[model samples]
Target: MQRSSYRYLVVDVFADRPGAGNPLGVVLDAADWDSMRMQAFAAWTNLSETVYFLPPTTLDASYRIRIFTPRQELPFAGHPSVGAAWVSLETGLVSDTDRLVQECAAGRLPVRVVGTGPQRMITLRAPRARPVGIEPPPQALRAVLASLPTAGLQAALWNNGPSWWLMELEDDAAVRGLAPDLAAIAALTQATAAVGLAVFGRTPAGADHDLAVRAFCPADNIPEDPVTGSVNACIAAALDAADALPGHDGRYIASQGRELGRDGRVALQVDADGEVWIGGHVQGIIDGRATW
Candidate 1:
């Protein structure tokens, strides 16, 4: 029996509150594992996604990371990238090095660690977002409205690298308390070939945040993602069209998880040049060994 040692970190991307943000499991030092083993390990953790860290085969990068969901492997995932980078930092994979690069199936992405505080912020460079072609049926709008918690809001669809259904609510409160029908959403999204749906609105009357959001993707097999970086990316593009982003700086704060009572938050920023950066703090959850 061959035994392999692995360290896993529980990280919350896009939220400061412990249980509020999107959860990810980082398995550090997973070397030479095939896709089948990786898939099994990811299903074991059962988080939104689990990132496996591998030593770089070449000197071109620092580490190799693979992201997997319980159902399948993902080419790219936002929270997993942030969580993996944080795990690398915590595990001493990268020292006082302010800059770190990780190789993934998507490609090599560079990360810039801002500060060393308890809630350390790290910004990741997203690959060039090439919008894919999707022609959703006219019923997409109606299905979206019917599945939403609020019926009074207007919904718009956008393709920011990934297909996204953007719902603009009447108020921050409306966006915050949304309860979506996952099965319905998944069916519609899959039928329309949309990646997922993003619900958003202005901050509540007494809220400190700028906007509230929630994402649903049953076709992707995700139900009520606590915090979604890809959805935020789509929001960035949508807001750019509305000229709603402050100073037109292309950077904004997106709030999520409140609907689920988790209350997670994500920082969304995009440059005029179309570069996107998403970040948040993370915490370690568990670590152990895997025998196969």
Candidate 2:
């Protein structure tokens, strides 16, 4: 017996450079790939996440896609969807003439491709976010502000369906260039009732994005996410709905990964229709095969 060879492409999402954006493995035309094999491959890839593509079952459908992290499968993912959709459009799996609709565990998602050349962009609509309420475990707050001076740090909880611990910082400096205790977060996540942690605050004048953020999910196998669209989407929604966005109303940009040096920027737009649009540029890192 022999193991079937699986062909995949690696992409760097939310990055203009090779080693910058979050890396993702996109398996082109992975109809033959099973869930078990995909899970194994995802863990082996060891990237934040890997996306597998499948042909639509119905003629009216566009494409069916699945997202997997190292330890678990996700209902939705930001970078992988954008990267995979870009690959799909460029590879002719999806036509440029028609907009692409990707079916995932989260539900059907639409990705619109735009522009030509380096500035070309892809915008993804995160699953409609509802106010998850607000209150967090006490220790989770301590874990996030562990590095801070505690002068202006505050913690709260938001529980819609996914429990998120929202932490507010004094300024941009407190938000960026700091590290969270991953093990503490893992422990707090178990000890608490929340699903993850979201740290959000204003950005300094120098950063590229309007807001800076970092997310941690102990159970999700991601301690500190390089950049998470959905998490940011949820945060943006919460802020916008609560009338917390600075001078502007209902629109913002989020910066992530500054501490890890990956530094990623995500464009966010909150519409009156109650939808959040996250747009970013993705680059193809290794277009060839990985022997391992």
Candidate 3:
């Protein structure tokens, strides 16, 4: 029996509170595994996404990571990046406690550790996101979005490694009340080479969050992503481009996953230069060694 050892951890990212967030699988000491092994393990775990830690090949990067969905590898992902960095810092894979740079296929990105202990927060600056494609939206979504207000934002594709079709509905109620057609969404995503579709709407005044968000990705087998960071960042970019972000300050809290029985909040910041950063609290789930 050949037992290849790797330290694995499952940490919930984007949690508003402990135990209420999207879970990410982190595999450490995975330098020995090739892409096939990594993909196989990702498929076996069946999480939205899984990540592997490897030695940094770049000069200033604290470490390198590879992201994989159950079906294929991705250049970058929001929750996985933040969750992996948390595990890295906690497991001493990284020397610095305050900040570290990550090297991935999307290039080097910065991660920051905020506060301390269980209440600590981790934030990552995503690869600069931008709206992509000027074509019309998929016909599959016409029935789904019929009569829904655009909320002053254009419906378009946003790209940040993965592409997502983002739209803003009338209000948070419209977002929370949404029931997506999985088959239609899957077909649309597959046809457009996109990961999924994300919809956001303004929450009522005085709410803890400024907006409500939802993501659907049946093409990747995720009927509804619990809390998604990448798509959140993309939506922020789109909102900023349209000048339709709530309060116009470029900093707001977004609530997601409530419809899925999970509560998670993502903090989005669009800097003066329009660079988008997403941050949230993480809760650790599983910590143990794995044999492959």
Candidate 4:
């Protein structure tokens, strides 16, 4: 009944401090694990996502990772990418301390690190997000948005590795106060081939962050994702396209997961070249071994 024990870590991503951000589980010695085993462990963790690292197949990459949700494998995800990079750097697995390349199913991505120790921030250059057409599911979308005032703002569907439907409400209060009909949202996401629906709104001035954000993903079995990076990245792209950034600047801070009692802040930026990057603070909370 003995099985191999692999080194694993649980890290907080995007939190200003411990126990405040999205939690991610990572396995470092999974080079030989098959997809079935990876999925099983990912399901057991039941995190928004879990990642397994393997030796890089490409010469230019620092490492390769396979990402999984409880129900399926993901080509790319924001938190997992950041978490994996942080662990790699912390464990001395990274080739370049300043910036490293992460190879995933989505592709090779750049991971940039700033500062050091607990103050370190890791950022991932997200795949460019673009609004795509979906089969009209206005009925379900309307049902989910019922009783909410959505004027002058439009719902956008974007695919940036992890697809999502993004909506910008009137203000942060509306975004936080929303209680969407989950069933309707589930139907719409299923029909559109998206992971879920996310909403964001402008926070009042003097707030710590520029926006409030929340995500619903019944398809992925996540009712409300604490702090979502992929969705936030796409939202930044959408905002940039519309030239609607709060300060007409290229970047802003977002606050999420407060309703769930966890404080997650995501820094979003659209660079001059139009690439959206998601950055946040990451800390290793638990470093241990896992038997699978």
- Tell me the tens digit of each residue's lDDT in model 4 across 146-232: 756554358878989988988888899888888777888898898778899988899888887898889988888888888889998
Residues 33-67 of candidate 3 have per-residue lDDT tens digits of: 89999999998998999999989997899999999
lDDT of 3: 0.86
lDDT agreement of model 4 with the native: 0.87
Better of 1 and 4 by lDDT: 4
Per-model clash counts, in order, read 3, 5, 0, 0
lDDT of each: 0.71, 0.72, 0.86, 0.87
Clashing pairs in 2: 132-159, 132-160, 134-157, 135-157, 136-157
Clashes of 3: 0
State the lDDT of candidate 2 residue by residue for 98-122, as single tens digits.
Answer: 3667787777787777874335588
Can you tell me which runs of candidate 2 are displaced by over 4 Å? 1-3, 58-60, 133-163, 191-195, 204-207, 218-220, 247-249, 290-292
Model 4 misplaced stretches (Cα beyond 4 Å): 1-3
Ranked candidates (TM-score, high to low): 4, 3, 1, 2
TM-score of each: 0.86, 0.85, 0.95, 0.95
Off by over 4 Å in 1: 1-4, 136-141, 147-163, 192-195, 204-206, 246-248, 290-292
Best by the lDDT measure: 4
Per-residue lDDT of model 1, residues 208-267, tens digit only? 567788888776557877887767766666666556763236666777887777777777
